[model samples]
Target: MNLPLHPLHLKEGGHVVDFHGFALPVRFSSILEESAAVRERSGLFDISHMGHFEIRGSDVVQAVNRLISSDLERVPSNKALYGHILTEEGGVVDDIMAYRFGEERVDLIVNASNRDIDRKWIEDRLPSGVRLADHSDGHVGMALQGPMSPRVIGKILPSLVDMGRREARTLSWKGGQFLVSRTGYTGEDGWELFGPSSEGFTLYSEILESGKAAGILLPAGLGARDLLRLEAGYPLYGQELTLDVTPFDARLDFAVSRSKGAFVGKEAILDASGKPIRHEGHPALTGFFVEGRGIPRTDCPIENGSGAVVGKVTSGGYSPRVGGGFGLGFVDPAFDREFRSGVSGKVRIHGQALPISFRPWPFVTGGILRAASV
Candidate 1:
């Protein structure tokens, strides 16, 4: 469960923790400071614990297209597509990124916690002539994220800085193969590097040290990442998304390809279609902010002033960007719609119902969606 960057993190004063079986840095400095570094400039993050699976063969594209929910026909080579791997019943198995390397090969980046399960799920359905390889253990991953991330990365890998959004390229570094993809979890322009462990460590160290003179690129951790993603309105796997929740419930409809024809979970998802069919009285995910001193935490019941349980907080915390409490949770569709229009709701803490309201979306945005930010 030890990450390839474990030693490097220790050497750089990262406060490490046991996150989903792997030793991960919770914060390099304070979470707020690290987050500010990303907002204002850039930050480096170690995400090696995430799973990477390579599928190659003549029918690779067809196999991947049939298994995942996104329309891959349009995603050209050297590009990445974000989508969900779902169960037949329309439940999300895991949200993953598929890096298309033409019609013959693909690389899927999946969540660390669901690595084995996803691999098993995917491999079980592989057709003849297609190959599956769990290359996660052999490589390390790092993210350089922020608005000025390109400027910072330009110092070392100038060519990769302009690879365009969701695009990927390969390079040879220190006698090892390195892949740089313009992809990230935080809603910002960034690059994700995947390569041999030693090379990855070198890349991380070089970027942090070299970028210091130009722009501040701090070493970020899980704490800042969570807050940034929340502010970006991005859903976490175990939180807003789960095996019990369909894409409709999670508001991940964009990733679901209804026109792509016959993929896993398509039938049930079409039937569910924002209803409570899956969870039976289900609540769709929504964003909210707490006023004053109240900070909502996961599993806290959300009510509508009449003392009736509408939903529960899935991810909640203080946002440095919001300068107040901000979190995401699932609530009844009607209640969510009402609160989204600026109407107030209540979050039950202990026995007190503190007033709260839905905070539209992309709480703070400097993401690929420039129009949304504007």
Candidate 2:
């Protein structure tokens, strides 16, 4: 479970932690410092623990499209599309990114923790003309993120700079071809690159050295990455998304292709969206900022002006950019509008109810210079 970049991270003073059975860095210097570095400049992350799969066959697009919520045929060649693999009941199995190379080939990047689950699910469903290849163990994934990412990445791989957002290309680096995508999880203008495991050390070292020459890049870890994604209002698999949560409940309607004919869970999803089952008060995801001294945490109760519990925090943390604690949580559909417009919302942190304000997310964009364009 040791990553290809494990030694490099250790040499860079990373604080190692066990994450989903993989040994990964929790922080390189400090979480706060790393967060700031990404916002102000750039940060490099080792994301090799993620699963990579390749589907190749004459009917690859049609075969893969039947399993996910998004329509692969609609995606332009060499572009990536984000969607979820749903269960029959319309609950999320996993959120994934699918990169289409052509009608005959497609690539997928799935969460590290769900590698086996996703593989098994996909393998069992693939039709006769298509085949799936698991390259998770043989590949290394790396990300260069933030405002200065373009500059830093350009120093190492100049060809990647011209790619538009969500664009993917198989380009040569040191005489070897690898996949590079103008995509990232940190809500920054960045690129996620994948190459052979054997080239991991060299690739990481070269990028690190290039970043150092610019004096604007830092080695970041999971803590900062989590915070960045949270600020961006992106959902995490185990947090905002789960087997029990549907895309409708998570407010990810955009990831679902309602027009894309019969996909897995299509009927259930349409039923859910059309006539939502109001379990747990019929929750809907929303963002909030704590207005008092206390920081919010997961499971904290959110109450209305009349003191009725309307929602519960799913992810919460302090962000200096926000000037205090911020969170994303699920609330009753009836109160979604009131909470979104900053009316009558309060979150109980510890034993006290703290006033809160609501806002749309990608909460802070000042540091996302390059991302702004995309």
Candidate 3:
């Protein structure tokens, strides 16, 4: 897939890589530099590759409520809600954010990789009178994040500078209008903007020019984004979440609404006892920090005292903010009970079971300048 920002990335000397088939920037300078920019100052990311879909009609609200696990009853107009889509068997199809505009119109931004599966799953169950449209081709998306993000946005969209978290508002620049939401995947003060694909290049340049004087905003890419989300304890679709992993296993209970009544997979997700099942391995994704001088990688075996494999690392990296190597892995919740200060286990690194410790997934709290995406 081609990105609207590809030409700009090349002009800026970004190192591009194939991420889930789309060629995009991995970094403009260094991963550490870009990641630091978002944490301490500000950064802009091109996330145009994510899938965009919309549902509309008088009954769209009701149709959406039945499709996802979250209760949208209180999701006020011009705000967004995060939730899950499940198979009848209770496994996750995709995690999504529903942006509500009115009683009838709603836009969904889902993971880019789950484009076909998520659209098909939702459309198949869409009720009569509701309409679904894939808007991925019509728009380009960008994320502006960090403590200085609000200041940068103020220069471009002064009206949106005061917009509350999770809220959406329309803004126009250069005769091109679009939606800007106070939402983001990174654990920072950020906003996601969706506008005409034709205006993408101009928007990127404008933001750069607007914030360059203050050294607050810099172009960032996937490498920095991955680390920032991991630091925030957010789950990546293909990593912590998968078709085989339910929201329960992902520790995303806050997104599920049992009291909202029926939704897809409500039955299979709950046991006869009316609770989310832990399924095989009793796996639950949790965060961890390296005990000493070890780095963890994906698929690294997590083991107990008896050296039995209990879980595997999902995402791990050096956390520049924490000044330590950190990781996220799925482990038996029962093992979590064994924590004194932290859960000690053997993390198979480089063919050796290096001793490791498991703590809560979010290594840092309140680091995000704004409210979390969900």
Candidate 4:
């Protein structure tokens, strides 16, 4: 397959690896080193493959609010929202980031693999006057994430540093203009930049060079990105979230605005919220820390005290910062109490049972300095 490369991939001797059909860098340096760098200092990521769309019309906000679970009415221009586009039955279509451009315009950032599906879904539900345009092809995106990301990038791009979390502004840098948002997937203070593809390459080079001079930033790869996001308690699309699962099941009720009026999945979601919690039929997403070696991989069966299958692992890996294995997976809530009572459930990995215990999300802390200040 012909793999597509992000602009940054062209600059950093990025060893291209096929990731879900897109050519992405597995690592610019070593995965372990890059992973450690982001946890300790800062790292830059090339995420241009993510999809972008422009929505415009008098009814754009209304149309968008109807399509997503987030409350868009209070979302000011140049601010972004993290939420999900849900099916009429309340199942998640995709986890997305929405940016309000103006009263009549908005932009949507969606997962790369679901780009076409997301665009089509948004268009199908748009009111008659609304217009939806796919801009993924023309724009490029990148993220600078970690504890030192804000200060480092701020020194190079002063305007971006001043922008608070979820805030965005159009600024000029390296002889070009770009839209920079103070946001990231990794639980840290950082910025995500979007602009013309050519200028994106220039900005990527400049940022990398600037970070190099600062000696605190490095080019991070997908491996580091996964570990950082996991530690931060951020869910991955296909893993922690999926079409078979509703936002409520993922413990993302905050994203669903009950007072925002009717949306595509409003009725179903509201009904689900009102019903008594069921401990069976569906699995509850929970966090777990491993007791021994051998990282848990996806589809690893989770068994209860009596050796009965309660659920299965969805995402798991070692936390370099915590120095142990941690993971998120679906488990029967009925047995949740048992696991809480020291029942000692085990995760089946590679034909061996690895003892596990439940742990809370956000295995890492202290990065919410900006949000806390607010």
What is the TM-score (0 to 1) of candidate 3?
0.94
Global CA lDDT of candidate 1, please?
0.84
Worst 10 residues of 3 by lDDT: 365-374
Q: Report the lDDT tens digits of candidate 2 across residue range 1-374.
A: 78888888889999999999999999999889998898889999999999999899998898899999888999999999999999988888999999999779999999998999999999999998789988888578898888898899888777778889889987777765577899998888888988887776688889888897779999999999998888877899988998877888998877888778778878876754544333454478888888878788889998998889998999988999878999988888788887766585899987899988886676777644222111
Error of 4 at 122 (Å): 0.5
How far in Å is the alpha carbon of 368 misplaced in model 2? 5.9
* Model 2, CA-based lDDT: 0.85
In model 4, which runs have C-alpha deviations exceeding 4 angstroms? 1-13, 172-177, 272-280, 369-374
| Best-first order by lDDT | 2, 1, 3, 4
Q: Which stretches of model 2 miss by more than 4 angstroms? A: 175-177, 271-281, 366-374
Superposed on all Cα atoms, the candidates' RMSDs to the truth, in angstroms, are 2.3, 2.8, 2.5, 3.0
Higher-scoring candidate on lDDT, 1 or 3:
1
Q: Candidate 1's residue-wise lDDT over 177-268, tens digit each?
A: 87679989888889998888888888888898888767568889998998888778888899988988888898777887766767877777
What lDDT score belongs to each candidate, Candidate 1 first? 0.84, 0.85, 0.82, 0.79
Report how far residue 299 has shifted in candidate 4, in Å.
1.2
Report the poorest 10 consecutive residues by lDDT, candidate 2: 365-374
Model 2 residue pairs with clashes: none
Off by over 4 Å in 3: 271-274, 280-282, 339-343, 369-374
Using TM-score as the measure, what is the rank order of every candidate, best first?
Answer: 1, 3, 2, 4
Best by lDDT: 2
